[model samples]
Target: MTTRTQTLSQAGAQSGILPIIGAAVLGAFLLYAAGFAEASVLHDTAHDARHSIAFPCH
Candidate 1:
């Protein structure tokens, strides 16, 4: 029983790594893109996104 519990816990921990890596990669991409992207492009993208989500950018 103890061994089974340990195995399940290990499996759960391993499964979590993929999402963490994906988030890290996505964050890096956003940072890099924002660093070099045009100001107007970013603003337009953000504005449209806000309106799409009904976040009241105005």
Candidate 2:
């Protein structure tokens, strides 16, 4: 007989995979879009993010 903790853990593990897959798909889509996007557009979108992370953008 499985304990409640074991049951909850199993359920959580199964459900956790969906979010991981979704994030991976989203990341891939964003990467693909960025690849085909214009340089100016990319620069504009990431300009603030680069500055926040202390990355040189200029």
**Candidate maximizing lDDT:** 2
Off by over 4 Å in 1: 1-14, 37-58
Pairs with backbone N, CA or C atoms under 3 Å apart (clashes), candidate 2: none
lDDT of 2 by residue, 1-57 (tens): 579889998888778577888999999877654443447888688777666766556
Output the number of the TM-score-best candidate: 2
Once fitted onto the true fold, the runs of candidate 2 whose alpha carbons sit more than 4 angstroms away are 1-6, 15-18, 27-38
Worst 10 residues of 1 by lDDT: 31-40
Q: RMSD of each candidate?
A: 6.1, 4.9
Cα-lDDT of candidate 1: 0.69
Error of 1 at 1 (Å): 24
Clashing pairs in 1: none
